[model samples]
Target: MSLTTDLAQAKSRANIRAKARAKSGSETTPAGEASPSPRSRRRKHRERIYQWLFLVPAVIYMALFFGYPVVKNIVMSFQDYTTATFFTGEAPWVGLANYAKVLSSSLFSTSLVNTALFTLGSIAGQFVIGLALAIFFQRKFPLNGILRSLLLLPWLLPLIVSSAVWRWILDKDSGALNRFLGGLHIVDTGIPWLTSTSLALIAVVGVNIWIGIPFNLTILYGGLQEIPDELYEAGSLDGATGWKAFRHITWPMLRPVVSVVLVLGVVYTLKVLDIILGLTNGGPANSTQTIATQSYDLSFHEFKFGEGAALGNVLVVISLVFAVLYLRASRRSVDE
Candidate 1:
């Protein structure tokens, strides 16, 4: 009799549990509706809208500042827009005429070759000397931090100021550099640093190298600091200390940074205008004239806006190509 009573109570409890579960389910979610309450949905939607609103200003700024200029330049490249265009409000489309005019000019080849040489020489000198300086600074020394900070003065100063300072130093007559060389009897006379057609480009490239060294040194030094000391320790165990360890470990580790630095150096060197304009003004028979200087001369000096835009577009294309190289290097760096 007692066992029968216990079974009856158990059945009743089971029925109660079923009804409770049904009640709870009905309260929690109605049929076929998985979403939360309307208030919560509205809150989430508001949050999403706020997130988008935060990004709107940045998007708008980029469109106005960066996007508009590039588009305008491209349009100008295809149109015959000059100083008169502002008054007349007419810029007739000329298709590829502007491109042809600039490309067919005699100075195009010279500018292109000068651009190549300038980029190569500046990047090579900056990277090598910067790397050497970075390595040297990695060692324990008195006033190392102060000296490294001071090396950044050239890069921190305005390009015009740096160029002007260099111009004084490189002056043919009575310049400090000439005075030093004469005192040492190195040249026996004041060398024309920025005057000679043969030497102006070289002088400009050297100044650029000086300007770029601090950048390279700072980046490479940071990259070197990221390298693990344990790797060097293990490498030393295998008789890989000085050059061999650097060749095997450091080079492999630093290649990505080197790639980034070189690509950036090339891009920056290619677009260099201020230094050249300030220092040489593409003078001495246009020997120092690069694509950038040429473009500036055409636009501002000669009022050939269309031709200048075309040359500027060429530079943009070259930069875009190098940008691809940079992206590849960055991706490879991340992968490795």
Candidate 2:
């Protein structure tokens, strides 16, 4: 009789549990709907609207500033427009005449070539030197903070100021560089650093490289610091040393940062103007002329505003192409 009573209690408990589970399952279901609660749905919609509201100001700003100017520049490139024509409203349509003139000009060709060379040389120099400095500074050394701060002086100074200082140092006569070289008997006479067509471009490129190095060093050093020390220790445990460790670990880890830096460096170097203007002014027989200076010369100096606009447009296209290529390459690297 006691056993029968225990079984009856156990059956009652199981029945109660089944009823409770059935009620819970019924509560979780919507009788005729296959969707979330109205409150949850409303919250998601609110979140999306909030996101768009946050983005609206930026979109409006771009349309007003960037989009408008780009369209205006394109229109100006097609018209026989000038500062005077703009105010007078008497410009005529030229339909690619300016582009034709720009393409045919020997000066434009030379400027493009010089721009390419300068960009490439400066980037290579800055990258190699910056990487070396970054690696060196990664080690714990005395006065590292002070040294790093001093190194940034080149990039921190105003561009015009840096260019002027370099100009004084590289001056053909009565320059510190010439005086030092002469004192050391490195050369019997002062070299004409800027007066010669051949040397002017080189001197300008050198100054640009000097200015860019500090920026590269700061970025790359920051990237290097973010890499974990444990990777190196792991490599050491595996009997990896020196180049092998760097090749297997550091290079892979740093690839993304390096790609970003290189792309940015290329774009910035290609658009350089202040250094060239302050240093050479595209003088010494126009040998140092770049697209930026050429555009200025055409529009402001010669009053060929349409042609100048065309040149500027070409620069924009080239820069855009390079940027797109970099982005695509970066994406591919990530995908692989």
Candidate 3:
């Protein structure tokens, strides 16, 4: 009886000691891991802060470079900012006056039409030719890699260089194009490609199309390469070959990439300035004058900084709408 009682007392004392120790010690995680110490937690937080320090420079750079300019442009759009304002620092508030003036101008209408034509022509020509070339290169040929690399030359050249080269090529007199045409006896007189009002915009669009071809080719080719051969083989079994195969298997699969390419092309084409500036300078009665070039002229030449900002914002709004569309397309692609 006494031994049994002593054993019970000993067990009770052990239980009491264990409970005391549990109360004094740190809590544990669900997996029975002891909680981290305060000092260790502080050290971990400090380490995380050190990791975030790497992004500080990028944040600052974006703020100073892109964010500040966009905000300043928006503010300037609402004020009568000009060369005079620059020196005197007295840009009077003008609300929507700048926008009303720019939008009502006949030049704005001409520029808007030109922008539409330039964008459409460039995108259409670039996409069609690029797709055709991409399909051709898909087949095996001698020096295929070399030729493909060389094809990128136009796109790889700097815009300024391309503009200068095209300027010489398109020069009505003593130009390579005119010389070639003369050799073929196509025309007795050289065609005024840049100097003529009717032809200058067309010529600008052609140059932009040429510059944009290789980019479309490269991207579309990559998209084509990603398509599974198994799909094509299966498609063939179903009597879908050649044109039919492309129409069904290839076209359906390539839609997402096509959407992305078209949107990006439109955005890029809208902002083109250097090529037009170098080739025509929006000359011959503002034939090649686009919103981009007009904005440049307004800000620098006419000293209408507020109007320039307003025009620039219009471009920005247009780009943002396309950007949203791109995001939705991208999301749909991901969902698929």
Candidate 4:
């Protein structure tokens, strides 16, 4: 009788356990729904972690290199960071005094104007010539590869080296350019290309254009190649050849690449220091003094680190504005 009672209690406990499991199943997954297994859930979590793991190196790199320098520069901009600070290890906070001093100076206006002119002229010349070259090279021809490779020489050469070569070429005396012009009877005497205030900036812009052309050509050519030939073939069937095809199809397709090239060219041209310093050293009465050169002068030459940091920050702000504008424009274009 006792054994029979124990069996009955055991059966009742099993029924309670089975009913609890059924209730939990209904509550958790409901009917017609399948719940994820623990193995699948863990696998998904592992996949997410793996994805983040791939990004860790890039995050750490940017933090250590780009982030720290930017933060340090910004902090230094507001302080009297100078040679004295190095010895004493004290950079006193001076609020906006550095910015005021930099902005109020007469040289700042000249540098700003020069920077604008240099950027605009270099970009315009580089884009126009580079696009022409890219289009010309798109056609199959003999020696095309060789010529393209040769064209990159100017860009591959160091900026200082290029500047030195250009300086010799543009020298007021015994220069290749003057001699060539004299031979052609274009001018009677040696032109002081670098010495003259009016001509110094022009010469620098021309050299920058020469150096930048190869980069523009390579990028634009790649973009051109990506365009399908079938589109051109179809357009030709519709009497869209030459200018008509370019205006209707090529221009529309190349617009995105052109925008990229222009923005990058502008940003690069803005902070051009080596070329200017190598060519003119912001001389001829500070005619070629750009913001970049000015910042270099302040920090290294004058030992005014705070003012230099301020100018550097200003340039960064300008670049950021252009980048933001490009992003907005790109978004709008995508939406449309």
Candidate 5:
């Protein structure tokens, strides 16, 4: 009886000692884990601070450059901002007047139509020819590398230089194209490739396609290279060859890259200004005048900065719409 009583007292004393230790330590700390030292906590906080510091430059750059410009452009579109406003530092708020004028203008419809036709023609021609060239270059042949490198020359040249060269090449009287045609006796007279309103846009589209082909080829070639060769090998074992292989194997693998190329091509083509400006200067009865050129004409030539800003915003909205559509389509594809 005395020994049992002594054991109970010892157990009670052990419980009291454990409770005392618990009261002195962190209540929220896990039973086995020691509380974090102040030095370790400070080190972790400093690491987090360093991580944020790395992002500071990028955030600042974006805010100052991209964010500010977009906001300024939007504000300018709503105000009567022009040369006088630049001098006086005062741009009168004109509400939707600038938008109304831009949207209601007859030139707007013409520019819109031209923009659509130019984008569609340029994208279609660039993608089709580029994909064909990409596929062709996938084969092994002598001088293949040299020829592929040479094909990139058009894309490497400056837009202004390309336009100038094409301008000379398409000249009615002495252009290389006309000269070649004349030598072959294909026509009695030189075709008015640039002077005629009907042919001017076509000529410009051709120039753009020539310039854009290399870009598409390079991207699509990379994509084709990324596709696994084993897939082709396995398909060949299953009797898939030539067009059948391309249809079942090559295309599905290339769709993601194709989507990127098409989206970028459309966006870039929509805002094309320098090429058209240099080629025809949006001339020949304004037949090739797209929204981009019209916006430039409004802002610089006419000094209607507000109207120009409004027109530019319209193009921006169109681009945003296309981007949004692409995102939604991509999401849907992923979901499926």
Candidate 6:
């Protein structure tokens, strides 16, 4: 009985010692509460510095290139400054006169119409041809990779070079296209492809479509490849075939990619200048003039800086509108 009572007393004493140690360990120290470890503090400081350092170059470039020019152009559009006046430091404020002139001009209307037609035609043609080619190439075939690479040749070539080649092929007397067509009795004589207004516009659009096809094809093919084969198999097991399969399975899967391509294609086609410049120079009567070409002619050729700025501003507005439309459409599609 005496031994058991001694053992219980010893156990109680051990528990008290352990509780005292745990309490002391839990107590916070002054130094520990005052500051965090050097490593963690240094890491946080380094992250902030790196964040600003990474953004610095981009901010500087935008201020110099995009911000300054936009401000200067806006200022210039309100001033009536000629070549002489530009150097004389005597530009008169013209308010809305430059804008009024541009809006009232026949050239502006014609160029707007031409630009619209070109943009729409090129987008339609490219989408059709590219989608067709992508569908055709989705299957396993011989020399498929080789053919795909060869198809990109036109797109890879410099725009000026492509324009020059097209010009030669469309030449009245000595062009290869004319010769070939004549041999086939397609035409009675060599037609003036570049000299005719309607034909010139059509030819420029056709060349743009041809050049754009490869890029669109590549993108569409990638999208097609991403679609699971299981979806098609399931579609086939149903009563779906041909167009029904594409409409229900392929199109829904490709909607996002198609939206992106359409937006980009519209923007690119609207801003096309090099091809038209090299091919026709907005001739044979200014029939192929687009906003980009018109801007060039106004600023450099006619020395109307204010008018050119207005035209550029208009183009910017158009692009923004399209971008907004695209975003809304994409959002609605996703919601659906």
**Candidate with best TM-score:** 4
Name the top lDDT candidate: 5
lDDT of each: 0.90, 0.86, 0.89, 0.90, 0.91, 0.86
The reply for model 4, stretches above 4 Å from the true place, is 1-35, 329-336
TM-score of each: 0.85, 0.87, 0.83, 0.88, 0.85, 0.81
State the displacement of the C-alpha of residue 96, model 6, in Å, after optimal TM-score superposition. Answer: 1.6
lDDT tens string, model 2, 220-315?
999899899999998899987788977898788888888888988988988898899899899889889999889878998899889999998998
Rank by lDDT (best first): 5, 4, 1, 3, 6, 2
Candidate 5: what lDDT? 0.91
Residue 255 of model 4 has an lDDT of 88
Clashing pairs in 1: none
- The CA lDDT at 84 in model 4 is 86
Over 1-336, each residue of candidate 4 has an lDDT whose tens digit, in order, gives 443454455556656767886987878666543777788779868855755565566667778989999999999999999898999989999999999999999999999999999999999999999999999999999999999999999989999899999999999889899999999999999999999999999999999999999999999999899899999999999999999999998888888888888888888889999999999999899999999999999999999999999999999998888888788877777667
In the range 166-285, model 5's lDDT, one tens digit per residue, is: 999999999999999999999879999999999999999999999999999999999999999999999999999999999999999999889888988999999999999999999899
Model 4, residue pairs in steric clash: none
Q: What is the lDDT of residue 257 in candidate 5?
A: 85
Q: Tens-digit lDDT track for model 1 on 60-129?
A: 7678988999999999999998999989989999999999999999999999999989999999999999
RMSD to the hidden true structure, all candidates: 15.3, 14.5, 15.0, 14.5, 15.1, 16.4
True-structure lDDT of candidate 1? 0.90
Model with the higher lDDT, candidate 4 or 6: 4
Our tally of clashes for model 1 stands at: 0
Q: What are the per-residue Cα lDDT tens digits for candidate 3 across 1-336?
A: 443454455556656757865876655434533677788789868755754464465567678988999999999999999788978999999999999999999999999999999999999999999998888898899999999999899988999999999999999998899999999999899999999999999999999999999999999998898899999999999999999998999989889989989999999999999999999999989989999999999998999999999999998998888889999999889768
